[model samples]
Target chain A: MRTDLLRRVEDRLRSLLAAERDLWSGVHEGAVVPIDALAELIASGGKRIRPAFCVTGYLAAGGDPDDPGIVSAGAALEMLHLSALVHDDVLDDSGTRRGVPTVHTKYTQLHGSRGWQGESRRYGEGVALLVGDLALVYSGELMAEAPRSVVPEWNRLRSEVMIGQYMDVHAAAEFSVDPRTSRLIARIKSGRYTIHRPLVVGASAAGRGDLAPAFEEYGEAVGEAFQLRDDLLDAFGDSADTGKPTGLDFTQHKMTPLLGWAMQRDEHIQALITEPGHTPDEVRRRLLETGVPDDVERHIGGLVERGCKAIADAPVDEVWRTELADMARRVAYRTS
Target chain B: MRTDLLRRVEDRLRSLLAAERDLWSGVHEGAVVPIDALAELIASGGKRIRPAFCVTGYLAAGGDPDDPGIVSAGAALEMLHLSALVHDDVLDDSGTRRGVPTVHTKYTQLHGSRGWQGESRRYGEGVALLVGDLALVYSGELMAEAPRSVVPEWNRLRSEVMIGQYMDVHAAAEFSVDPRTSRLIARIKSGRYTIHRPLVVGASAAGRGDLAPAFEEYGEAVGEAFQLRDDLLDAFGDSADTGKPTGLDFTQHKMTPLLGWAMQRDEHIQALITEPGHTPDEVRRRLLETGVPDDVERHIGGLVERGCKAIADAPVDEVWRTELADMARRVAYRTS
Candidate 1:
């Protein structure tokens, strides 16, 4: 049932883009560029983790399998993620995403090669800005098809993500925010936004608002695990599998929780990050020597356990509980 | 009646920001920065044209003046405009808006003064990007409170504006996209988006979708007049009254319709614009000497008459038609 609905979610996205492409193509040949950018990113594979959780949440809450609103809610989550990623890439100055040149990078190069009138950097980033804005708008359009009851949760989810992102950017610049700020950002961004709110959005679509409390607990635990895994992946994972350049958090001086721990153990890590001529390799070795990686691994294990416990008595079927447990393990352990 | 509704619109905006300020203040000290930036812009002042058109359309369509949804819808239009302005300032690299420093400029200076970790330009623009994103989300939240039937027009209005912006940016970069393309953008951006759609959204909120055709005819005519008047104002108006620097269009080499007309008469004007060392005074002199400004003024007069005529026989009361006619004249002949 989940698979069928997920397939429809993909269909919904494709059809929406197709319709837009047709609508704009009649206006001007260049009118479809932003739409094309969005479609290409959607075509390029993403884990669709938000959609997966949303779907699983709906079904687990006894949502009818045939309801199309679930599909729309799921698709809206993915579209919003695309919007965030596109803008986030600009914020991070990331050149590549999902093994492809980023929207900004591609267009910036286009401007330069074409000898466009304005600064190529501005033109490129400007295009990315509008594209992201369009995706953000499209996400709202897709969610409009969902049940009206999903409105409150969806609204909270979006505003929370934007606020969390703002805080993240501000904290990275200050570079001296307390570790508690790092944890709070992690929970706001990863735990609540990526997991908890999506699950509740799905549950609400299925007429199951009662599932919110349990979903929040489960989401917060699993979300932190997911984020910890992300930090570890960025530090220790492979670029080939992840499809993005690793160690960006390091180069950008992002104050990840893992980095926070390493800095606490050894102050030199800060100079290595903030100053020039130091490689990511040097920072990696020093982090390992701090024994924080081992501690992080153990903490991730405890988090997964806690996440599973959250859903154990969530008024769901045994099958769903077991499935949720397995999903938590996958989220906590699997690499990008 | 309109005054009462407009007052409610202001209250809605202030109270909404106050609520958001309180909500995020509890989270972190710095979390309220973006929300505050938005509030400052709203409080600074704008023409509130879109909201005025929306309220007018609703009242003319016989929508209940007591309907809280109209206030929400009016607030949403203004919020969306604020989002566009914040982002537009970044794209244009403009220093001031409404007599205050643009959000990006203020934050960029903050980053520089504080000796923050990242590039000052990136930090400031990133802040603006997210601040604009928040406003976009907030607009959606506001619109959700209106009648559900406004969805389709609302969707089309948003996507069209984004695409229109993308085209505008692209046109500004390529420095040439044919006269027809410029007109299309002007119509898409000013006519359909600023006037027609807002009016239709108002009518839709009042359950009067059938009024869209007349609104479109009137909006397109008046919107074009508005854009032309804007061009002339940028070229000739005083900075003190507009609360921003004048002649930005000439400095930025924007392919406005007025510039298009001027270039057609004297090709030297193009060189004066695209190259440095030539002042806006020189460009303005050449533009006026070509006598295109006179023609544009005459064209604007024709447009206002046409706009009023489009709604002369609509089912609305005679008072509304007169009020709309007065609005058209005010928009076309405004000094600022």
Candidate 2:
């Protein structure tokens, strides 16, 4: 059933992207570059975790799995995710994503190869920015066709992610390692949008707005677990598995909860992070010796336990409750 | 009456921004930085031409001027403009806007003063990008509160502007100075959103969707005139008067209609634009010698005349016809 729903989401996304490409192609020959970039980015696959969560929420709330609205809304969630990823690549100066050149990198190469007249970097960044904005606009356009009750949640999801992104960037700049700030950023940036809002929006679309509070609690737990696991993966996961280099958070000196906890206990680690002279391997070794990743894994386990309990307590069907529990375990323990 | 409506729009904007600020303050102490930056940008003040056009459209379509929906929709348009401005500053590498430091510049200063860890410029640009995304989300949130009939137009307006921005950047990079592309970019990037869509949105909110075709024609003409005047001002208008440095278009070698005309007529002008060695003053002098600004002014006059004629021919109240004509004249002939 999950695979069927994921397949539906993939199909819906492809069709929507095709429509956008067709529209831009009608505008001008060159007008399709950004749209084509977006299509390619979307084609590079993700786990479709958000859409899966959304579909689970919809079905748990008694929505029919066959409803086209569910697929469309799920596709919208993916587009919004793509929008964030495109902008994020530019921010992180990441050369590739999902083992493919990022939108900005692709455009940079295009400019370089064509011997374009402007600074290739600037032109590339500009195109990426516009493409991100276009994807965001398309996300909203898709969600507009979804059930109206979900619109407010959709709007809140968008705003919260952006605000959380600001908080993340701000904290990084300030070199803030406060655990509270780290937790807040994690919850708002990843937790809510990744799990909570998708569940709430999905339930709302199913005409089960009343289920939002329970879903929020469940999602918060699962989402926090998801992020904590991500932090662990960033430190220790295989690049081949994650499709991204490990130790990015450490090298970037991003104040994840794991780092915040480690910093509180180790002055050497704090100096390494604050001074920015240490290599990722050195930091990762010291961090492992300090047992921070172990602590994060323990926290993820606890959160997964809590999430499973929340799902059990939620006013949803037994079958969906089981599925939700399975999803929580996968999210908390996935290698990627 | 126009002044009263404009005042109302301003007040609406202030209160909405205040609400956002208040919301972020509750989220986290540091979360308010981007929101505050946004408030400062909005307070810096634009001419509010888009809002005015929206109000005029509402009044022309027999909508109640006092309807709160009009004010909210106008605020949405303004927020969207702010979104574009923030992103534009990043794309243009502009240090200032409206005589104040741009968001990225201000944030960069903040990063510098605090001796933050990462590169100040990257941090600043990241914050600006997130802030722009937030503003775009807020724009959609506000428009969602507007009358439902205008939603499709609102979506189109957002997508068109972003698509147009891509075209502008692409043309600059590819050194494509085709007049047709320039005009299309002008219409899509500035004209439609600035005048046409606002008018259509206002009218649609008033249950006058049938009038969109006529309003679009009028808006296209006025908007083209407005952009052409902007190009001329970029060459000839005083920095003190325009609140921006002149000759930016020429220095950037952006494919404006004025540049398009000059390039077609003069090899020296084309070389100066395509090659980056010449100074802004040199380009401006050479462009003036070619009489391109005069030709642009003449084009603006023709467009303004056509716009006024469009308004006169439309099936709307005569009072609005007179007011719109006045607007067309003001937009076409303004020095700043």
The most accurate candidate by lDDT is 1
* Whole-model lDDT per candidate: 0.93, 0.85
Worst lDDT window (10 residues) for model 2 chain A?
Answer: A270-279
lDDT, candidate 2, A95-203, per-residue tens: 7788888888888888999998877888888889899998998888878777888888998899889989888877777766589999999999888999999998899
lDDT of 2 by residue, B1-336 (tens): 657877887887788778877887887887887778888887776788888899889888998777788888988899889999999988877777888888888888888898988888888888899989988888887777778888889888988899899999888777665999998999998789899999999999999998898899889999999998888888778888876667778656688888888888887886886676778778888888888788887888899888888888898988889999999999988988
* Model 1, C-alpha of A96: deviation from truth (Å): 0.3
Q: Which regions of candidate 2 deviate over 4 angstroms?
A: A1-5, A274-277, B1-4, B274-277
TM-score of 2: 0.97
Assess the local accuracy of residue B119 in candidate 1 as a C-alpha lDDT between 0 and 100: 95
What is the C-alpha lDDT profile of model 1 across B170-241, one tens digit per residue? 999888737888899899999988899999999999999999998999999999999998889899889898
Per-residue accuracy of model 1 over A99-210 as CA lDDT, tens digit each: 9999999999999999989899999999999999999999999999999989999999998899999999998998873789999999999998888999999999989999
Misplaced by over 4 Å in model 1 are none
Total clashes for model 1: 0
